[model samples]
Target: MKFEKESCSVKELVDDLYLAHQLLVPTHLRFSKEAEGDLFIYTDKKRLSQVITNFLTNACKFTNSGYIKLGFKHLRGTDEAAIFVEDSGIGLSEEEQEKVFSRFFKQDEFSQGAGLGLSICQGIVQNLGGRIALSSKLGKGSRFSVVLPVYKGG
Candidate 1:
């Protein structure tokens, strides 16, 4: 499938998140917003949502109990924003963190994913002049953060 990039407004993006939440309501989902600034970014709209969705999906799959939080914060002294999707689920190991974004890298031995989700997220973020990172502790949780440059007018 061909993927096309599009511009998205922060408010609209949150709306999309709500829609996705509605679809997954049966999964006992919870959302908490902690955005501090105007959450706007210049990137592929569809792919960006895909990134968040993938994170949430993975969280739900690994989490047996506890809450998932989608948080946002703008870094000071820069026109960059950080979006974090944190989950209180079974986290990854140090070695897995190093290769989480690598192509075809799956932590779960029984997982059937092609392992391109995070890889695609990395490429999309890089293409938009941004970076992606993650932090996790086994038996604790994982937090995936994407730092993207804000789109200013020409």
Candidate 2:
């Protein structure tokens, strides 16, 4: 995918995501209260949106009914911003977490998808000079965060 970086609003991006997935009602989706105002970041909007979209899609898939939160926080004392998508869905185990981002890796052998979602997310974040992380507990839920350096204008 082609990537063109420029100053973009995180709020708008997150809003788009929330709108797209908002109808999952019993599975309420919202932006974190801590995410306020317009936070600008330099990156490829499409690529970043794709990564966030993937995270939300997965969240919507695994979560039968609960809440999914999308938000970003400017990391203090650091030049990075943390964009996270969290879901109250089936969580992954420690062993599964290790393999979740591996190409063609899926927990359930019969599940849909080529198991390339997280792997692609990793590459996209890395391409944007960022990294993705995960925290999950089996039967509880999962949280995925992508940390990208905040863009400072030249």
Candidate 3:
């Protein structure tokens, strides 16, 4: 891992991710326009891209009709910020959510992944001084949030 954090344009990062996977979703599916103005964050672009793409790819795989949103926001009254992956797909139960990030944990054995994406995401976020969170309800959908501190002075 490069593990380098430097001043970088968030817009560039977002655009890259969008271009990389936008076509993978079924032609009829559309990404939500949830991204806002560009904001800089000191971070490793590669790892962050990996994390975001992992979330997006998983969401797209499970979602067939509704939208998937990827966006960033600064927590109100705080320097903390987050990148979120929200999807309208089969949601998980509390018991399932507990092991969502565990190695080899798979929601469905027949799903395409090797069960390493979320576990890797958690590690990457933790190394970046952030944490990955999930909020979901069975039969509704899931939202995965990766929270981190904004750079004070990179």
TM-score of 3: 0.91
Q: Of the candidates shown, which would achieve the greatest TM-score relative to the real structure? A: 3
How would you encode candidate 2's per-residue C-alpha lDDT over 1-154 as one tens digit per residue?
7789999888788778677756643425443423766677889999998898888778877877667788888878998788898877889999999999999998777878999999999999999988998999988889899898877777
lDDT of 3 by residue, 32-111 (tens): 64666666777888888889889998888877778887777777797777778898888899999999999989998998
Clashing pairs in 3: none
Off by over 4 Å in 2: 24-34
Off by over 4 Å in 1: 1-7
**CA lDDT for candidate 1:** 0.75
Models 1 onward score TM values of 0.84, 0.89, 0.91
- Stretches of candidate 3 off by over 4 Å are none
lDDT winner, 1 or 2: 2
All candidates in order of lDDT, best leading:
2, 3, 1
